[model samples]
Target: MRVLFILILLANLGVYALGQGWLGMRPEDEGRDTRRFTQELNPGAVTLTPRPAP
Candidate 1:
């Protein structure tokens, strides 16, 4: 159906937009420290405080 095709096209476009950051998708490791840490981050760390806010 035409409606289904349009929906699928829109969904694909949304995925492309997200992948390209047009939808504001953030990298999970964007602000992570590039230097090696002596220990791994605890799973229970509050707000994922690895190094510091960028």
Candidate 2:
């Protein structure tokens, strides 16, 4: 039972790691993504400029 549990736990961990790492987002795509998706899904929307850092 313990071995089975460990195997299942390892498998779950592997899947979680794969998803968190492989499926993770690219840091470079953040800003453009919002505007890109917004315009694609909704027309006639004005895009706001990035806020200046405080």
Please report the candidate that would top TM-score against the real structure.
Answer: 1
Clashing pairs in 2: none
Q: Which candidate gets the maximum lDDT versus the true structure?
A: 1
Model 1 agreement with the true structure over 1-54: per-residue lDDT tens digits = 999999999999988887777766446546767565656677566564478778
Give Cα-based local distance difference scores for all models.
Answer: 0.74, 0.70
Least accurate 10 contiguous residues by lDDT in model 1: 25-34
Worst 10 residues of 2 by lDDT: 25-34
Give lDDT tens digits, candidate 2, residues 1-54.
999999999999878766665556544554565655555555558577899999
Question: What lDDT does model 1 reach?
Answer: 0.74
TM-scores of the candidates are: 0.47, 0.42
Question: What are the C-alpha RMSDs, in order, of all predicted structures?
Answer: 11.8, 9.1
